[model samples]
Target: MKNTYIPITMEVEKNYFETSDRMIKTLRLKFLDERFDFEPGQFCEFSILGKGEAPFGIASSPFDKAGLEFSINRAGVVTKAIHELRIGEKVGIRGPLGNYYPVKEMEGYNVVVIGGGFAFTTLRSLIEYMLNPERRGKYKSIKVIYGARNPGLLLYKDLLENWEKRDDIGTYFTIDTKVEGWNKMVGFVPTITEEVAPSPENCYAIVCGPPIMIKFTLPVLLKLGFPKDKIVTSLERRMKCGIGKCGRCNLGEFYVCNDGPVFNFEQLEKLPKEV
Candidate 1:
């Protein structure tokens, strides 16, 4: 009952919010008239023909229908190809394809988003979507705890600033190294999250990051009383096809491209530990 790829074209590109030491957050590709209706936490498969295709989260929110954007880090071969795309360049695209985060089900519940390094790319979409009035009232509280190696390594500085100013959302940031102007928490995300100790009662936690970060945070969330189903995540694995047909992104009986890029802790237990 589900279809796999789509033919989309490039629309625009933007600069990084600021300079970083080890990582760069490029507001890279914008696909035009994508009509790619993806909710927060969903991904699309992108290709450069011979260069090969890779799955990427839809970084822009569902609120912005003008186009879709992916905030990518210069990490791998495929990402390098994606980063090299020039404005007006047409890269092959095939999806808004994976399962999305559950925004409505989170209604009236406190929401916590745990992001590490590049995982901010995906969580940013959910943050923006929840910020919109068309959907804002659904959640009671919003807290974002994000981290990277240093201040420069952090993504979306401008968006983080705006989120800090919002009375409705609680935003906290940290870096592994203390920068010249930095004065927030100091440590890994899991420790800082444990320090904040958000209540898990009637709450939902959306976590995404490097494997280690997720591994550390899960135990902390469970200790904080979040049930397995109340904690969700989007796991990344190797992929060529955006659809499940490739069999490359599978875990036992499930495929990341089909059953989820998004899943609850209960479901994740059945899959191999990504870490």
Candidate 2:
């Protein structure tokens, strides 16, 4: 088995700001050795040598041969160090750690993707995986409901505009409040979700966002008749050792790094209300 504690070396392929504030940045890292394959909803331990490491979701699609992607918020030491990195800098990546979204199980079912703010990282992975030319036929209709504090805060602006032009997927973008030039929907995530009211029949809903947004959004999905088992979400926690030995990311008996960052509503119900 591969040693979970050791990190593989990678080179920073691309680095850019995802939002206007520059608080969140996106990194595309090229593998220096054999690539570590990963699926959507999985995360990696990104390290900057002496600065320490942090767990971030893999934001690129599995079929993306260019490199792995991570969209990180400039919240603390490790992330701040990461933000300072320039193109061609070397870095450490520990894993394609944690479980992934159930794309295999989602085959033949319509998918509803709901996201807010930075948590859209993995949801982007899921969307890209499903929308790939070879994989698109495995799933039915796909709809996305995404919101941010404002239009400027949304991630993947170029891709969002491109997706808006495609007829294969239904994309809805919203903001917390209206702005002068903003022509799209204006409302909170949960409110926009309720407005979309995607059908539960033959479908699964995947949600990821801030805890507060998730707390209210679940009820809207449930009210729309989605079964607990069919509604899924990814969790964020204070993870130290990406392999789950640190015990900081445990929810009941499960470790977010090992058993999941992904869990359905039925599975979440068995854990404490921390989620």
Candidate 3:
């Protein structure tokens, strides 16, 4: 495929508020048009020039060309700077890079997507593509089990509420600790995931979250008989440049910035276990 390009002058950018702090800050952005080609689960690197760059998934669905969105957490240096930027201030960006979740191969299969806070970003991409009106029959059931540190931390409450009310996909949530105003399940992600175990037969599972949460959840998924290869994931790492040259984020021979920010559990098992 020919390399598609987005000139720096037209890179997507937008303003968003932290509807709450429990999760991460929201970035309202633009994807240009229905013509901007980006596969679900792919990410772009956001740059602040002086401060640095951080990688973020293009969270909003491809179907919504009005804008692209980044669901970011104010974690370290680059992200911290991102959280402070004002609307209309230009931030450098390049790409909708790396492999995206494969919804095409997923056609006609039962699907279960497990996400947490910011990592839930890619899952939204997959869900959006699956739910688009012209694409709905591409998959069977799609279930989401998402959570955060607490009630205040859930990202995209407006979207989640809308998703929860949908008949097409089943959604559930949990938190690491209890919140006074919260009404959903309470416990660590893996704990609750084991309880709400969606079937693995005739299905595929995709998980993205804190490393520790993944550390525990993968085994639970295995126990539930999800095929290791079919258990997909979008790996997380510190990313400076969206391209492969940067050496900061590597797992043995794999560079998270390039070869993948997205990999299946099967691919991950063959790599250095730290991933």
For lDDT, the strongest prediction is 2
Q: Is candidate 1 or candidate 2 better by lDDT?
A: 2
Top-scoring candidate (TM-score)? 2
Question: lDDT tens digits, residues 230-250, model 2?
Answer: 999998988999787989888
Model 1 lDDT per residue over 1-275, tens place = 33455546664466453345634546456656545577898887777767877778888888887677777767787777766666666776677788889887898899999999878777999999999998888888899999988877777788898888889999889888677889887889999899989999899999999988999999999999999999999978777676778798888778878888899999878776542
Please list the residue runs of candidate 2 whose C-alpha ends up more than 4 Å from where it truly belongs after superposition: none
Candidate 3 residues lying further than 4 Å off, grouped into runs, are 1-7, 10-14, 31-35
User: Per-prediction TM-score, please?
Assistant: 0.92, 0.98, 0.89
Task: Name the better of 1 and 2 by TM-score.
Answer: 2
How well does model 1 score by local distance difference test?
A: 0.81
Which order, best to worst by lDDT? 2, 1, 3
As a whole number from 0 to 100, the lDDT of residue 59 in candidate 2 is: 95
Each model's lDDT: 0.81, 0.93, 0.78
- How close is each model in CA RMSD to the real structure? 2.1, 0.9, 2.7
Model 2 residue 107 distance off true place after TM-score fit, in angstroms: 0.2
| lDDT of each residue in 141-180, candidate 3, tens digit only | 9888998887667777777888889999998888888868
Model 3 residue pairs with clashes = 22-152, 22-153, 23-153, 30-68, 31-68
TM-score of 2: 0.98
